[model samples]
Target: MIKLLTSADAMLYREIRLEALAAHPEAYSSTLAREQGKPLAWFEERLTTSDVFGAYCAQELVGVAGFRRVDGAKTEHKAVLWGIYVRPQARKSGTGRRLADAVAAHAATRVEQLQLAVVSENEAALRLYAAVGFVEYGREVKALKQDGRYYDEILMALHFGGQGS
Candidate 1:
């Protein structure tokens, strides 16, 4: 099941977020160390400010994804897909796709386009986004560096035609 997370889920959110940053350090822009040191209130504040969703299994939060609109008049029609992650046990269970779709569907209701960046070599994630109608429009060279190693990211977006086809 998938549902928008609330401030009450902050602890669960922090736990999973730290897991994401640690398991795949190159996949997210935020460092594990950075988030790990943050207080629960920070995560609670994030829930109040962002559109974050969580996937559950047997009432346990197994995955999470977020949608945040760019702050500016010119960028009001766009939102970014961020903090997409699923536990190892949750992999291959269609949890990621479900979470991504939930965020995109909810975002489409308000934005003209939903954008995301994924590390180029993450084939499963690439395929999952493509399946949801997000097409790559650009790629950044060595966009992210971790432990002195660089990783490229493919920039993708799904356009909502009624507003900006």
Candidate 2:
């Protein structure tokens, strides 16, 4: 099952987030070193402020994806998708697709475009986003640096016309 997470699920959310950061440091902008010390309240605040969706198997939280609308009036028609992660055991089971669909469906109602960034070397993620109708618009060189190495990112966006214009 996939659903929008609430503040009550903060602890679980933090656990999965830290797991993602640790398991795939190259895929995210945030470092585990920076987030490891954050309190549960920080996760709760995130849940309250953003649209984060959690994927569950039976009772275990196995995946997560988040969407946030741009703040400025001029950018209110756009929203960014972030933090898409699924446990290794949960991969190839459609969990990621379901989470992506949920976020896109929700975003289509609130924004004219949904955007996201994926590491250039992450082929699986690029394919996933492409399957969801996101097209590459540009690339950012050295978008993230970790352990003395720099990584590029592909910026992708899906335009939803006539829905939230």
Candidate 3:
């Protein structure tokens, strides 16, 4: 099952978020050390600010995806799909695709485009985003650096083509 998350789900969200940042450090720009020090209230505020979706299995939150609209006037028509992750045990269960679709569908209601950046070497993530209609428009070479190494990122976006105002 999938549902929009709220401040009430802060604790669970924090746990999963920390897991994602730690286990897949290469996939995210944030460091586990940075978020680990944040208070629970921060997570609560995040839930209230960003549209976060959770996928559950028997009441356990196994996956999460976040959406945030751009703030500038020129960028107001765009929203970003961020912080997407599914637990290892939940892999191959269609949870990631479900979360992606949910985010895409929700974004379509409020923005003309939904954008995301994925590490270029992550084939699974590339395929997942492609399956959901996100087309790559560019690639930033060495976009991210960690521990003296760099990784490229693919810039992708799904355009709603006036379906969203």
Candidate 4:
């Protein structure tokens, strides 16, 4: 089920986050071991955030996606999607789509646009974003640094002007 994540779900968040980091180091900025050192309070705070959303299956946390609400008095109408990850076994199912849909729906309530940065090399994620109506606006070179290497990212955005159906 897709629902807002609570502080009580911090352990599950940590578990799935580490799994994502370990399984796909090239997909994220933080390493598995690096995130493992984070204190429980960190996850607790994250789960309690107003912008965070998560998906659970059979009582097990399988996916998570969230964003920081845009700041500034005028820019509060936008949010950038981040920390999106789903278990390998859960891909290709409706979980990813559901999570994306939930995020978009949630964003629409507070923002006029939903934005996310996807690594150019992550074709699966690129396709998923496109399938959900996130058109590519442009590319940012060397958008992330990992292991002393640079990774380019595609900047995609989905405008909420009668797009959601």
In candidate 3, which residue ranges exceed 4 Å CA deviation?
Answer: 163-165
Instruction: Please name the candidate that would achieve the greatest TM-score relative to the true structure.
Output: 1
* Preferred candidate (lDDT higher): 1 or 4: 1
> Model 1 Cα displacement at 69 (Å)?
0.6
**RMSD values, in order shown:** 0.8, 1.5, 1.6, 2.7
lDDT of each: 0.95, 0.96, 0.96, 0.84
Candidate 1 residue-wise lDDT, 59-134, digit = tens: 9999999999989988888999998999999999999999999998998799899999999999999999999999
Please report, as a residue range, the 10-residue window in candidate 4 with the lowest summed lDDT.
156-165
Error of 3 at 73 (Å): 0.7
Better of 1 and 2 by lDDT: 2
Residues 1-165 of candidate 4: C-alpha lDDT, one tens digit per residue: 998888887888888888888887777767887789999988898777756677887887789888678888977766888889988777888888888899998887878888888899999899889988898989999988877889998999988864352
Residue 6 of model 3, lDDT score? 99
Residue 84, candidate 1: how far off, in angstroms? 0.2
lDDT of 3 by residue, 39-80 (tens): 999999999999999999999999999999999998999999
- How does residue 38 of candidate 2 score in lDDT? 100
**Residue-level lDDT for 6 in candidate 4:** 83
